[model samples]
Target chain A: MAGENMVGTVAIIGAGIGGIYLAAELGVAGFKLRLHDIDDARLADVRAFGGIDVEGERGGFAAVELATSDLRAAVDGADAIIIVTGGNAQAAVARSLALLLRDGQIILLVQGNTGGSLIVRRALDAAGCHADVAVAEMDNYPYSCRRLAPARIRPIVAKRWLQIAAFPGNRIAAVHQRLSPLFPQAVAAPNALYTGFTNANAMLHVANCVANAARIESGDIYKFYAEGVTPAVARLYEAINAERVAVAAALGASVPSLEEWFDRVYGVREASLVETCQRLTYNSDGPYQATGTPSSLEHKFITEDVPTGLIPMVALGAAAGVPTPAIDALVAIVRNMTGRDFAAEGRTLARLGLSGTGVAEIIRVMNEGFA
Target chain B: MAGENMVGTVAIIGAGIGGIYLAAELGVAGFKLRLHDIDDARLADVRAFGGIDVEGERGGFAAVELATSDLRAAVDGADAIIIVTGGNAQAAVARSLALLLRDGQIILLVQGNTGGSLIVRRALDAAGCHADVAVAEMDNYPYSCRRLAPARIRPIVAKRWLQIAAFPGNRIAAVHQRLSPLFPQAVAAPNALYTGFTNANAMLHVANCVANAARIESGDIYKFYAEGVTPAVARLYEAINAERVAVAAALGASVPSLEEWFDRVYGVREASLVETCQRLTYNSDGPYQATGTPSSLEHKFITEDVPTGLIPMVALGAAAGVPTPAIDALVAIVRNMTGRDFAAEGRTLARLGLSGTGVAEIIRVMNEGFA
Candidate 1:
């Protein structure tokens, strides 16, 4: 109950799957919750059911103190605000919250795709919000969830471990202390740099998606990890993963190799990456198995992962003097396939307000505000 | 006809589909033909049958003047030497013929995949051969034929037109005059540079193969041109094709685009590349439809095309100062997937003995031999 008193009143932005599940779990844990979403029909559905009926892995008829579309009312006096919107909408949410956030409020991104917190921090500064707020981000969402209805959430699986870090990184300990009660499996990372580099979706999705683009477009129904990731495709995954590891090391963060990460998370240790992915197909109970193959090249696997995931890694690699030919090649192929310029639209060092900064200075800026 | 006295004797090298097809067509046309193949079993099969049974498009039972494994005996006193071994075996065939070849003999490569003539000429020099010889190449093989058995050949579909050019631009008309009696559809180009730039396999195979790699590895049985070239994949094809066109333009060679080439060759006038490929599947008679999907990553679609096809184009691109990001990206992905250094192993200016030469000089060398 370390955070029971400190994080008493919490606001959950985005009434999507992650937000709804968080509302039900926090409500059943005896904490006050307010939920907000821009979609009026969604809010209406939630109001009709009174609150979320949390199911799967945890059971409860949890109630929320308030449900509205108003940003100000949702975070008026809340001690913490958790954003569950995907990376595509994170910046806009941060911009909208710039004028409404209060002092001592904490904002945690459920999953900070590479440099998520840095993006929000920049957006808040651009909007001229002077609130003394701490921004934290997790490496990935802690739950694989679905909204059965607007007011019903089924958390398929809760991850065994989660990595969380705060902007400037100096306030990670205090932030971790307050968020531990909400996510018992959460562990403190040195900074958002570590959490951002720990993003697995970037390394796993784009190459496999592009490699299987025709299979997806032709409406082939097959297991994404088991069948889509062939031996050669798996080798490509390893090649890109090596570039990601080198970028993280150049930025003073040491993360596990993709194999080690898969071993730790899915517990599928095999001789090669292809075998590991095949074993993950049948072994990792529900998370990867439930992941549907993208029907088109426009799926989040490429549209979201390429710009937000691979683009940022390429930018960071350029900043740290690490050559990322494999990553750059993936980005180029995606751009050619989609006819979109992901590099220009992606989150680069300039977007993160760290353009032209050296490795040491970039690390310092990541741990300390630009001011 | 006209070439009956000018080209009375022909030497057909290799016992593969192309070589066997060439032997039957020439023998039936009333020319003496000598067939050579290193494989004794293949030559034995030919001797057992006493000739080639040409089936499909052209039907005939034709006899050869001599069938031998010895290189010297095959080309001795022959007016024309046609090398039908694929691009992979062309250099060795050229080296073996260097000392054995007589003065004023013409050597025609059925399908000189990018820079085929240059490779053969270089191999000839390295072997210390001093002989008066004229080297020529064709844009592509003339027929989509297969060997039904050791001595049985099926010419599925013969191309409507064939482009041929000699090593030195001054000798193309003479070479075309002597070869026209055997191939009435033959057209003369400026030099090997023009014929080499017209190679279509390099522009078609590698990108589509890489895009549909997973399907190929998973043993998916689908029409390669129709099912494999989806909309997104077709866009990638166009992107890489543009680089090839630009490289040709930089070298002062005006070539038709991939779409236009298909229109001229297949008579399929579709709006987009995807539709053209789809139409080609059903409308191109038997060539594209009969093309099977690759069964493995090691198939010649990649192993041969990437090295002999795209690699040479990439090297030419660098010499011409054209940026081939899309082509380079495809090369990088294939290299990463297969863990092979295609750039170093492929045809380059250095391999052609034209390193540091400008676009104009490279073109000059392609037209005029080093002498």
Candidate 2:
């Protein structure tokens, strides 16, 4: 594989579960690795342990070639910098590496919200730094994992499939070729817009948490997708999916409905969205078995989903003349419920530097790749 | 008082808590009472008991005078007809009385949704029953009471105040004069629009039920407002309140904020909305203390609230160019959760015969009252 021949130093940013597991897999593939994060305690644990111990199905101790709190040293000679944090951490990570980024250092955001690349690029530009670097995002991480301890990670499941798109979308093949060893089932996505709408994390989680809010905050442990997404909540997920699909249509991007997303991702063949969700949620080996209901209404389902998920969709739908009542409704509820003005603070087109641009311009920018 | 001298026979519809209590109070006030309902079992109990045996601080037996399942016979020569039931049941009662209603009879809907009058008016007109019946509604029921048995209604406390309005707007004073004996502290509302905006049951219940969905479904028995309205849920309630206020402003109507409503009603001078709610909810005599947390999301909190409370609000806000994202979102959530099309099926401008009208026309209709 080209990824093997092209193997070189790789910097894994954010010492989260994804970062640790990614490092283990890539280390097993024989690439020199570096782990970086602002979490000093976590970094110290990684430093003390000398590397991450990944368990569950794919168990291994990947020796650390380097572990550092320093961002520059992490990427000094790396072929690529893989960011494995929530979209919430993307901008901060971007700013952290703004002045330190180098030429030919590709940056990839695993399961980024749309505009994540633009944000990093803008940070570099603001720092008066220019480099010959390619940037990309995946529709999802290839694994659903969590940290068992600061030095250990549990790879719950190898998600089997992922869609990748490069900013300046023409680089998908070249980028995919170099990244294939780590993500064996990687496929080329049409554009970031496609990946953006198709990112099912927020789509499924937010609606389920909101619909089953009582259950989630009831202090009872429950499976999120199985117990939270009753037949009724499933219908909401469907409507929200329809709105996302409509936004894609407005942008001239093609993606599967949320129902089909579950089908494609988990490889389940079911007649309805609820049935498919029920199956995936209850699967013992699946990632959701490791997930629990958010303790209250103030968790990531509202915090991450609002700003990154529904907010941009609502704004884009408004700009595209497609109504997103369902998305807008959730935004309002969370905004009021949380005292956060997500609409004012979220990932708007203006924030993404695509304000006042039409659909063609957006699609054109996505495909042509920015300089 | 003029209401005492003007009192004649009165028909009490629905035979629920409010209906039974109203019968008891008016029967003590020396007016002949007719308790009418389609509920044969409840009606049979009322008939066998011959009158209601009331308990609590206000204790005594008040003769029913007449208990019947026959709607026409009950209202044959009534001075006024008081319909006491959930807002969801209002339409059916309207249709049942559509053809049988006579001239000069005053029909008061205790806490009927605004559309309740419009629907009954439309029903009467559709039935070719052109009569001078004055259809009216109250801001809320005059008591926090429930039926212990079919023959017994325990009114925990008398709601010291109520605001009355009639459909034709001009008939308010006459209706008030005839109906005020049962509602001693009743005052004439500027219009039905004011009363509609101030209906707090849905706004508080829906948000609390949704935010505290876990606790309710967990089989915990608690007072709804006191136990469920955490700071976050209180914020959602405030948003919903703001949206309701915006809708009223669009209609040129003024209503108290939910916070003030609780203050005025409960006589608690609490500073925060949550604190006020907590106090009122824990007060043994407060209306809310009489209410229990909904058993499930499927209860009236979502079902009745979304349709009767939020659907009309979203429609009115849209027609008036007022953005009601908070109300719209709750409607979407509940609609999907219940598999119901509340917006399409619930009260709307079209249903209220104000579909294509602009803001000025809406205000005009609200002030002038529809004939």
Candidate 3:
């Protein structure tokens, strides 16, 4: 309503679980949609089939008018481009999207960690795409879906209160006014920083995986959350949450209690962190269990979470003179587990244009944005 | 033989699994022994049964002679007092032993941490028990066994090359000479610091427990070591080993590779850590698994290891200007799971009498045993 702009044509990049699910929703909603992915076979299958078969929750087969591997075909004439991929995959998408990004286009990164928006912006600028795009990031994806097949997704759980924020806090209204049609549940967060620290994916996934390393390695079939979130583990989860909140406070951001966030998103109202974890852990029939546990720590729990989720927190905390002992400790252990220097390789405070910046400066930069 | 004196009478404190096991081993060796524990019921059972029922590799029932709860009577005429309780329980034993300790008494702290010798020595000094005692500690116990009943122990595996070091490095030969009948395979370690850092129980137990937290919490019974020792976890073990070795090097002590130690203790000849873990883990019915995984993180793996094993490593590493990031990280995660400040609560550099001491001074203190 603010801009009187209807984002009719949207490009959904990355044919992963999130990508396919988003495309199905938009395609079913009667929006002109283009789906792009690096996988050639997947694109061909979707094109040959005329659309993806979306099942579960609200089931349907929605026609994707354009399904292509070509960047230009996907982005041309598109008002908005949503990158539904892991933080690691985002850079490659940004690298390719830079060449075809159009002026006034809106780019939204789902579950972007700190500096995620900045990295894409830099890539676009470096590629000479001088598109005056409104780049935004959500704290998490709106749906928990898994790929039933290459051209199909089973929508497991549709989450609520998804938090999205444009890179420059000022552009949030315009971005929200346009994309709200697709994501009606998403509310505008304060800024990119707010969404970055608000992410709970890494906090929940990493420790559970690490603690359950033996079980996962043994090739035992079991629900990940319901059984995994024991009272003891829930206690550990609280400590990590406290560290994250402290990091946010150091950067002049107030994060909602993880318990509160869990209740809001997953609908558990337990006051005790352990009790909440215990309740949700064994809900094997729930949306989270559909994905199953990763067979190895080499999966996203260590790979994506460590770099995107944890590294940024540590870097931000260090830049602001905060002692994130617990976060720092987990990072140290994980680096050895994966043999990767996440601090050097992941999204960092310096990359977020926040190095040497204090709380007030970080807040100011987040509001104004770098790109 | 420095003293040319045999330790005629020995006092075995703590009627727990290890204490009883040691008393059984020593009692079978035809040495005059007295067993003490806080639990009178356990002591009475051992006394009422006449001796502990030892069944396993070398099965036999040995008379315990006398078992009592009276600490004074247990220590009055003992030439040697052996404390075989956990790292955490060692302090209280030292506190009680301070009052009864006399000259020419050799106190052996089996598997005592770096602080073990120092704490007892300090307590004795404070109590004006100016006894010329040679306090020593073994890197680990000589055998892997558990108390099947209050008066029955089922030995799982008997290990060799038990590393023993007295508080004073010069006293190593003397201590070994005196206790050779009890531990024939024992060798002189560099010092108490060497034995302390060489402890691999926590390193193996903590990571495995933490990694397998989900499985343990779910009430699913599974083998801990063999099944728990996955490829990803093996990598973490190596990282922890590296940090520990780094700390050791900083303190001018050379530590063994965890792989070599496992091979030596468990007789697994696999070169790779993962392979070794796989080989050792499933021996579920074997000696190592006899200890089994704790039902919760509240067990010694977190409580004692974080403070005694990990915290001290980090503290010593910091004192010697070495970075123990991996050890620190695991400690952080475990602390949250258990909700205890291991660094403050457990054996620390300060508790070990090396708080402000530098590398040279620490080495010096190790050579010239305190008290």
Candidate 4:
């Protein structure tokens, strides 16, 4: 803890899966911790899980001396604020934090899917509290936690290396220094764009689950890590990866190949995306389950991945002249399968607030770090 | 009946559905009729149909003065022959006819699907027949019939138009003059390729059935005509149509739009291919039964349409700089779905024996008729 003395009280929001995991890790390492969540039951469970015993009515992790859903109370005395809310609740949480966050109090977003950091930054700007609150985003959460009960969480694999970066390049090292002690794996990405594009799991997993909706709805008997590597599925995986790479390239970031990411994350070697998915979900004793919808793949692949991930990549690919036939095909199939106008839902140059900029200008802006 | 006296003696081989219907039409029109089939029971049913009688037994139709399983006997005295056998039996039937047929006889093949005329022509060449035998093909037989019971034939809808064309070009008028009275709707197509591509039902209907196998097999009710036009299935129809159009263009023939063909064949305005199939097959009064092995659409669409119809189209489109994203997407999706390498499955240019020829050459050879 190089900054142990200087780093004051740390606030962990949501006390949900990610929040609980992070707070437990940090509390064990002797950091003064505050946890906030709307659910009191969750707070009670965290208290039982080795949190510092705090004798107060704010019954959270026994180690978390402060616990509340109040925005101001949570951020009042904090040096650092970490967000770990449900994906759907993120926008509201960001809006609330924008009003209450103080200057020089850093905001870190775990699992920053679909430009969460950028979204929160915009919220803070609208609230007139944008300066001095250095906002950063991690590609994914540092730890995997599943709920055992309403208040109980079971932490599984804590990722060994987490890529993160601040919106403004100036805050990179300072943010990393403050948060590194709480995570075993924390590294700075080039910028928010690099971190955003590297979160490939949403695109890959969602597409696979959606496309195989019939099989998934009947029963997810297949191992996603192994069977998902079938040649057909592998092509889809490649298409998705191609899109992600395109987005990263457009943003002037070097993104790793999906295959390399798979190797790093799951220890899969020479196996296709489908194979990797099948091995993990079907062959292994993992906690994955099938989607309930007939077009789950469409929902994830087309609705979520296309609108949020691939469409943005497609726009970028067009700029680069990289013929992404696989990505295009996936988009078409998902649209056909779902009968939704995904392009309308998608991130366009206009949607990404880059409307009027030429490719070069957009790339320059992205390279300069979302300022 | 103007050429009743000059009409040549006609032999219809294979007393199956097509053979029986053609024999019934021609025998009543005062042409010397001969019907032959391998199945004795089917031929017996052809005899039981009223108003026709035969003098001899080759296989079973009563209008045949002579019938025999021996091919030489059946072909010996024939002036014109119509081959109506199953596609799988094409080679054997062609060999039988070539061994015994005299020069100057006209052989009109019904349902020249999978290039049956080409197969027959190759077999005849192998048999070393060099005489001026006229080989013609009809897109499909002019009548729809089914076997109701042993020795009983059920006549359904008689197609209003039958497009016929003679290969080598010179004998077209003569073949039409001989068979015109028997078929009220006889018209001459430019060549076999025109007839092949115009039969769009084979291309679209088959793919729909195969892709929806799970729903079809599960007895989940489906109004294939009404509901199968879902955007996803419609995209598939478009993909299949694109392939057929490509093959037709390659052969220097005009391929009608699927919508246009449906109106012409089924008298339904704006009805999709699935609707046409439902109208034709699922009708209570229709000749076809509800249960049968899934038709060869699976093979045709996947094997033929993808490689022959789609791949060629994609290639041609590429050469012509036309963007056929719909066709391309379908090819990818089907390739992924079936895991079958359709490009290698006889539908591709190389497999179709058109390898090494530029686009112009392909068009010329198919238009000029098989050498």
- In model 1, the fraction of reference contacts reproduced equals 0.85
**Chain A TM-scores, candidates in order:** 0.93, 0.93, 0.93, 0.79
Clashes of each: 1, 5, 13, 38
RMSD of 4: 8.5
Candidate 1 CA-lDDT value: 0.83
TM-score order, best first, reads: 1, 3, 2, 4
- Better-scoring candidate (TM-score), 1 or 4: 1
How big is the positional error of residue B176 in model 2, measured in Å on the Cα after superposition? 1.8
Share of native interface contacts present in candidate 3:
0.88
Give a tens-digit lDDT track for model 3, residues A1-371.
22438798888888777777888777767778888887767688788888888886577887888988888999998998999878887777888887777778999998686568877777777677777788999888887776777778776667777788888887899899888888888888878777888887867877777767677777776667767677666776777778788888877777777887887777875767656765654464345657577877678877898888988887888877788887776777667667778889887866666677777887787888753
Stretches > 4 Å off in candidate 4: A1-101, A105-129, A140-162, A168-170, A180-183, A201-229, A239-254, A270-274, A287-298, A354-364, B1-231, B234-300, B312-323, B332-371
lDDT of 2 by residue, B1-371 (tens): 24443758889998866677788777766778899988867778778988887776656787887899899999888878888876777777777887788778888878766456666666666667776788888877677766787777677667665788887666678878777776778788767777777776666777877665545554557667766666777788888898899888888888788877766665675878778877776776666776766777778667766777677777788888999877777776666556678777788888777889888887777667653
Residue-level lDDT tens digits of model 1 in A1-371: 33443888889998876788788778877778888888866677667777888876557887887889998999998988998887878899999999998788999998888888999998998898899899999988776655676677766666777789999788898899888888888899988888888888897889898889888999988799888899879989989999999999999988778888777665667998888887766664656666688889888788778777888888899999999999898899888888989888888889878898889988888777675
Candidates arranged by DockQ, highest first: 1, 3, 2, 4
Per-model TM-score versus the true fold: 0.94, 0.91, 0.93, 0.63
User: What's the CA error at residue A97 for candidate 4, in Å?
Assistant: 6.0
User: Runs in model 1 with CA error above 4 Å?
Assistant: A1-5, A16-33, A42-47, A51-67, A145-156, A284-286, B1-5, B17-34, B42-47, B51-58, B62-68, B146-156, B284-286
* Model 4: per-residue Cα lDDT over A1-371, one tens digit each: 34542456789888755687677656655778888887767677555554632212322342677777677788886888888874445556877777677667878877666566666676677666654788888877665545555444454445656787886645678777776766647787767767777776555654464344334433334444444334445665666676677767855788778777656655554544554555545433233323123333443434555666666666656655566666676667556545676778666655556666666665555545444
Instruction: Select the stronger candidate by DockQ from 1 and 3.
Output: 1
TM-score of each model's chain B: 0.93, 0.93, 0.94, 0.75
